[model samples]
Target: MLQHLKDHSNHEALQLQLFASTGEGITLYELESGKETFPFYLTKGTYYIRIFSNDQPMKYSFTSSFSKGDNFENELNNTKSTAKLMIPNTTFTGTLNDGGYDNQFADVDVYKFEL
Candidate 1:
């Protein structure tokens, strides 16, 4: 999954950390600047996000799901109370063409071949 963070706050430096929930506690996944993007390979589960400024953590913690190929964008506004995180839905559409094979078996419309 790809996680992107944008810091719109007036603070010049912000500390952002990504944590994964475990059976015992939370595991630290990645720590980066608020203006940078983080990429992680995680299993299907939930995670905790924390953003800090001047060594003080934000009031509200963000939680999100981490599935395969998921992308997330988090924005930290200047007000500090109006932070937003966006999870976009990704959809794929395509057309399948069966090479005009009339002798195809039932329920077998697609065939795989190595070129």
Candidate 2:
């Protein structure tokens, strides 16, 4: 299961996309507004997750695989400028620049881990 939270109540809704590892370039699931994806069985392989806010210019991506008993959690702020991904025994925090094309802030940050 995947879960998310925002700092503000009136923030733009969040978007999520899931992809398989078959390299077929197809999306497995797409969701919005913090809704949880329905429980589905998955094979043992790599999977991709993409997250972003409806009105923000930044996007975040992650990769994971199915395990015996694993839980995942993701947290983001309303501005879509900060995020945290948590898994068993590991946590990754990311921050992005609000400047879309102006380069006012540094580029977005991404962290990858294997479990």
Best by lDDT: 2
lDDT, candidate 2, 1-115, per-residue tens: 4444444355655555445676432233343434364343344567665566666653333334444532332222322345323455764333343333335454544334446
How well does candidate 2 score on lDDT at residue 69? Answer: 38
Q: How far is 23's C-alpha from truth in model 1 (Å)?
A: 7.9
Local accuracy by lDDT, each model: 0.36, 0.43
User: Poorest 10 consecutive residues of model 2 by lDDT?
Assistant: 70-79
- Regions more than 4 Å wrong, model 2: 7-11, 25-38, 57-115
Off by over 4 Å in 1: 1-12, 23-34, 55-115
Root-mean-square deviation per candidate: 19.6, 16.9
TM-score of 1: 0.30
Question: What TM-score would every model get versus the actual structure?
Answer: 0.30, 0.33
Q: Residues 4-54, candidate 1, lDDT per residue (tens digit)?
A: 244435533444445557532222233333323334444457766555555
What residue pairs clash in candidate 1, if any at all? Answer: none
